[model samples]
Target: MTSDADPRFLRSREAILNAARELLLESGPTAVTHVQVAERAGVGRATVYRHWPQAEPLLVEAMATVPMPFLDKPTVPTREWLRRELTAIARQLDLDDVRAVSTTLANTALWDEDMDARRAQFAGILTTRLAAALDDAQARGEITLALASQDAAAMTIGPMYYRSTIERAPADPALIDAAVNALGTWAAG
Candidate 1:
C-alpha cells in the first residue's frame, strides 16, 4: 500500500486528479470512472481508487485546483477593496477553460451533497474575504447603505455567477464593471 509519505504515491495521486479533470471537462462527470481515469493517467485502477474513494470527492479536489484571484491583505476600506477583488475575479473568470470547469462543477454539485459542501466551502472563503472588505468600506464612509456586509458581498458576486452558470456566457469585462459600479452606487445611497 502506498502511504501518504511516499513521493511517488503523491505524484500518482496528482496524476489521477489531472486525468480526472481533463476527462470531466471532455466528457463530463459521468465519464470520469476510476478505470477511465487510471488509463488516462497511466496508473492502475487500484491506485486511483486508493487515493479517491469516490468520484465526487476526486472531482471536488480537482476543481479546487482552479485558480482564484489572490487578494492582498486589506489595509484599505471595503468598497475600494471589493472593486479590486471583483476585478481580479472577473479576470480569472474570463478564461474559457476555467469557466467551463467551474460551470461543470456547479452543475454536478447541485445533486451531490459532498460536492455541494465543497462548493459551499469554496464560496464561504470568498464571502468572508469580501465581507471584511465591505466592513472596512463602511467604516471609511465608502458605503452608506445599511446592508449587512455579507449581503453586500453577495450582491457584488451573485451576478457574475448567474451569468456564468445560468446564462452559460463568458464574463464580459464591461458587465462586471457595470455590476461593481452599480453595487457601489447602491451602497452609496
Candidate 2:
C-alpha cells in the first residue's frame, strides 16, 4: 500500500506540516518552499510535492495553524473585557510571521488574491467579536451606536494596528490598557 494508508503516513504529514509552520512563523510565506519543507522535515522533495502540489497550499496550511484570537461573550466588566481583547490584539501583533506578512497582505490585495482572502476572513472574525462587545455595550447604555458597529470596531483595533505596523513597537500592556480606557470612555459617551 502507498504510505497514505499507513499510520506512518500521518506522522510524516504531521512532520511536514510542523516544519512548514516553523519556517512560516519564523520568516514568512517566502521561506516555506517545497525544498525547504522537505529538508526541514527530513523528507524527499518529491514526497513534499506529492503531498502538496504547490507552496501556496503549504503556506495556507501553515498560516491556518497559527491560533487566531477569540473572545467569548464576557462575564467581566466592559473595561476588563476590552482589556482582554486589546491584549489579544497585542499578542497577535507580537507574532513575527504575522508582522512580516501583514504589509504585503494589506497593500497587495489586487495582485495577491490569497492574502486578500485571508485578510477578509481575519477581518470578519474580528468584526464579529467586536460587534458582539459593542452590542453588549449598547444594551448596557454604554455606547452610541451612531456609527456602524463594524466601523466602531475598526476604531477599536486601528490604534493597536498602528502601534504594531507603523510604530514598529512591541505589544505593551500599558498601551493595551490605555486603548481599553479610551474605548470605554468613548463608548460611555
The numbered model that scores best in TM-score is 2
What clash pairs does model 1 have? 78-133, 78-136, 78-137
Model 2 lDDT per residue over 126-149, tens place: 788777777788788775566666
Q: How do all models score by TM-score? A: 0.61, 0.62
Residue 36, candidate 2: alpha-carbon lDDT:
90
User: Which 10 consecutive positions of candidate 1 have the poorest summed lDDT?
Assistant: 180-189
Model 2 gets an lDDT of: 0.72
lDDT of each: 0.69, 0.72
Per-residue lDDT of candidate 1, residues 1-189 (tens digit): 668989999899889989988887677556677889999999989888889776656766765665434444765545455567776766656655446556756777889787777778788777787677666666667765556667755676777767766776766767766766665443443
Off by over 4 Å in 2: 1-42, 45-60, 65-67, 142-146, 184-189
